[model samples]
Target chain A: MAINDNNTDSNKSQKQEEKDLPKVVIFLPPPVFSLIGEESFASNKFLFLKAYDSQLPLLQFLSTHSKSIKAILSSGGAAVNADILQLLPEVGLVVTTSAGLNQIDIPECRRRGIKIANAGNVYSDDVADLAVGLLIDVLRKVSASDRYVRQGFWATKGDYPLGSKLGGKRVGIVGLGNIGREVAKRLEAFGCFVSYNSRKKKPYVSYPFYQNVCELAANCDALIICCGLSDETHHMINKQVLSALGKEGVIVNVGRGPIIDEKEMLRCLVQGEIAGAGLDVFENEPDVPKEFFALDNVVLSPHRAVFTPESEKNLSQLVVGNLEAFLSNKPLLSEYVD
Target chain B: MAINDNNTDSNKSQKQEEKDLPKVVIFLPPPVFSLIGEESFASNKFLFLKAYDSQLPLLQFLSTHSKSIKAILSSGGAAVNADILQLLPEVGLVVTTSAGLNQIDIPECRRRGIKIANAGNVYSDDVADLAVGLLIDVLRKVSASDRYVRQGFWATKGDYPLGSKLGGKRVGIVGLGNIGREVAKRLEAFGCFVSYNSRKKKPYVSYPFYQNVCELAANCDALIICCGLSDETHHMINKQVLSALGKEGVIVNVGRGPIIDEKEMLRCLVQGEIAGAGLDVFENEPDVPKEFFALDNVVLSPHRAVFTPESEKNLSQLVVGNLEAFLSNKPLLSEYVD
Candidate 1:
């Protein structure tokens, strides 16, 4: 009750100060903002109005602050659909603390002439680090062998099985975007030959490109998925593609789960059709297949490829920069024009 | 009885043909030769006479064939001591299927004017690969996070804890030998700053060298031990060095275990003085401390850093090459002059 009373007093003071500051509405608080310590974002130039904190419904909350709220802060999980956009007629800019903008209705924002800013290549290094980490884990059996050592099997079982060497492996990267490029750079140091499959061959990239996913999988020892999920990309890693990867091949998925057909890939892994997989995302997140728990070859992560503390700090800075730029009528730091 | 009778017939034929070929005495059959397939080493130029296969005792077996044995093939576990050398007065060369020459008495061999050949850099790349693998596994908590996921903690517990990034980490190599140099090369590709501590400063190397190991531990975020076990290096990584490494420093040992003070290191790890460790060797392998099984931060490997199929094949080739060179009086292929 004492805390509630203090919050009410602060709310009253905030209302009084709202007229002097630029108001920015946040649909849902990103995990990074909370992690980096909220006090770091305290600024006199802009006021962050959290829509989730309001007692009223989201639509009602937007209607109440529509005239004053000119910029919106959103995230990957929060929907920035046309319905919410229509409620805030004065909102001129939308800033997201995520690299992917699939949740946002880009066409609607374009029609309304609302500029969009995203956490661009800020997370590329972190995501790429995880992708390579997972690849090495799968290939070298780092996690499985650790389990063997932890379970007191090393002393009793004698020698642990030999792992395949990382050097001289042919790795095919799916989607040679920022994250994919970073992954390629790291793996190249291990002596792995890198090739890629993308929508179109990148202008400056000299890595061999395969237009078809199956062709890429067939030619390489492993495939790392780093592309975004879309109607065209959904279930792109299907049964045929998994078959192409073959019995001695590996697959590491750091991209959106729907980009791969999770059910088929699971069957392939269970049946030993493919050697192994290291997955950070699933078709339905936090609902991994039970079969994966029993499999030693596969390593499962709970969608944490982009959740390092350093990268989170970078994302927080980008979010603040975008908000500040939009308020002062300057160009957005990471504006996504398309 | 039938198998023994067949072996006797083969032994008689082997004795008959032994005089026609150059006789090479083997102290023991190395695991690499067996792994590479015994048929691969079958040659008419030199007949390998396994000392263990002789029905007589070792000394009697050596005395019976001493004059015929001009070259001796030994390994890490099989000692080529002064007694064995004195028995085989004709042994002018000692070929080892291991990189380290600790098992062979170097002074006695030099006094007898006998040449030595070792596995050389055949296993260096494989050992370096495991060192990097262990480092990545420890820093990223790859094995620990995998255990969390396997135990179904991801769904119930939500997001796993974030891992530290590999880039920008200061890694100090304990030795600047072939294996150590390979580790530095791979880590450099990950954007890690490499430094080193060696017996003497390597002239051509540019990385900062620390003559004192305690000074090296104090400056580096991680220490990778890659030196051989010797009188000077025994218990080199003692309490003072581990303390200097501090709370967040990681230690990876691909070298001999006695190089680190196992008892003190364990106490420090248990007490949270040092962050974590990745160990491929132990003070007494096949008898690891029970306490290590319970620690999630430590990754234990069963002394398998140098064992890989590719490296095993390379070792097989080197062993054959050394034997052929010794017989032809052409310099021994991986001759260890020191």
Candidate 2:
């Protein structure tokens, strides 16, 4: 009986020591963590102090725990700007569960000497899969035919209109990065000829390079945008590029939507200036142009190109890895060096 | 004036000679000819007799033209069985503008020593493209997600359900014929591991062979039915096989529908025994089960797998090539030797 009581006390002390270890803070839990279940992170090295549970306001909660919170796990919805960063003076690192860091203030993080880790190539395959999937859906009219079948139109209207074939089409990939390269690989298997337009030609890439987006659009049957959004690339696919793509051309975008001039592209699609489009991201997401819903030549997705179950699992592993690396002062798994 | 009269008389004689060329009879003009325009075939060597305009019963029409009609050009809906063949004893060749010969009585054609040509391999690429398209649509939920966005569900519901990823999935192709091989190639580009079950182990193939479909289903994450419908293959994917595929399994059918037990498959899908399905061909096409319309896990297409514009062009060329070969007594371009 005495040995059992001593063992119970030691276990409680060990649990207390674990609770005293370094803390990682999350305001609003990321979708990945919630989807995978919060219990999965229960056995990790550090403690996760959820600010949402605090009775105080966010700024007040942060100021109260400023001395204890050493790391922040930011998600797409939570903006990690200078104001938030200034509240946690002891915070040394911020890890995001998304491929893009547009929500995080990068220059501010750098000036404050705080390190950042992103989702890296964890989502590249899923994003590329959706891009190619959207391309095939548009070219083959998969979703439109689905509508035809569901509406009982096939029996009433006879044979559906023939769709264009996928093989042997000329496809130009804008921004031939990780996602673009994967799209190119899959397209090559379908017998499509691949070319590219990037800020700089990739040294190891074998696909044809075009310096101008208009020139690339002119030579290809479809343009797939995979480049990140920045000031220079915003509206890169303008009216000139869409016009150069011609009336028989197609456009697919899995990257940020502002990279394309959405208004000009919509005008082209409406007037039959372009053949079709497959869009997963829009300039203003969740507020898609109502005009697009009436068109048969376009496929609209709900900006979920990177949210597969497999990708979510990968993202969870990456988040844990980044947090572990940050706690130990090791190199971050997917540090945003730029 | 004398020279002009002489040339007109010679042209009349040449016209008569042209009419004496070997005859090719078409009861109903094929859609390919109508699509490409009948003028495209006007310059060919053989003379096509329009039986539809004869103002006679089909049998009587064939009886009257039996001596002139050397070949019959049959489309998908046209039947070239023993009765039609007996009406025209002089007809030695039958050319069909479809891949499947289910419409023609193949055994009777063999018994009558009638040579046959089909639209061989012309639509293989297109069919394979659709198979892969449907698979991606199912795994990634492209059509369903498209519907969600179009119906304003994304704006109201916040986020759509996460779909399964395509990479690293173990896929079993039911048949390793032309279209199956193409499906394997494209899936490999996406990093999926492939195996197959076929009528016989192909000598030149390197993929692992499973003699039993149930075993294959047990081993793979998805099953793609690409085999033709025959007595032996009818209802091959029965209840036992579906059970072996388990709850996370997906099934994609680009093959004929009765290859699967449609009722059992529906039950499994409804009961959540299988994850999802993507069907292009159905047991009763153009009359899909009304129950499927309510299910979000399945993608319904109206049997347009091989009807791409490019494939139609290839089919036209094959038809012309077979007819020309038969007229000149050369080997048929796509002869159905069996």
Q: DockQ of every model listed?
A: 0.63, 0.79
Candidate 2 per-residue lDDT over residues B1-338, each given as its tens digit: 35698899999998898778878888787767766567655635788888887899988988888888988888766778888988887788888876666668888888888899988888788888888889889988999999998998888888788888999999999988878999999999999999999978889899899999999999999999988777778899999999999999999998888899999999999999999999998887778888888888999888888888788777777887888888888989888864
Candidate 1 structure quality by residue, lDDT tens digits, B88-108: 888888888777777888889
Fill in the DockQ of model 2: 0.79
Inter-residue clash pairs, candidate 2: none
Top-lDDT candidate index: 2
| TM-score, candidate number 2 | 0.93
lDDT of 1 by residue, A172-217 (tens): 9999988899999988877899999999988989999999999999
Model 2 lDDT tens row, A250-296:
99999888999999999999999999999999998888888899999
Model 2 spans with C-alpha error above 4 angstroms:
A1-15, B1-11
Clashing pairs in 1: none
Proportion of true inter-chain contacts also present in candidate 1: 0.64
Candidate 1 TM-score, true structure as reference? 0.92
**lDDT for position B312 in model 1:** 78
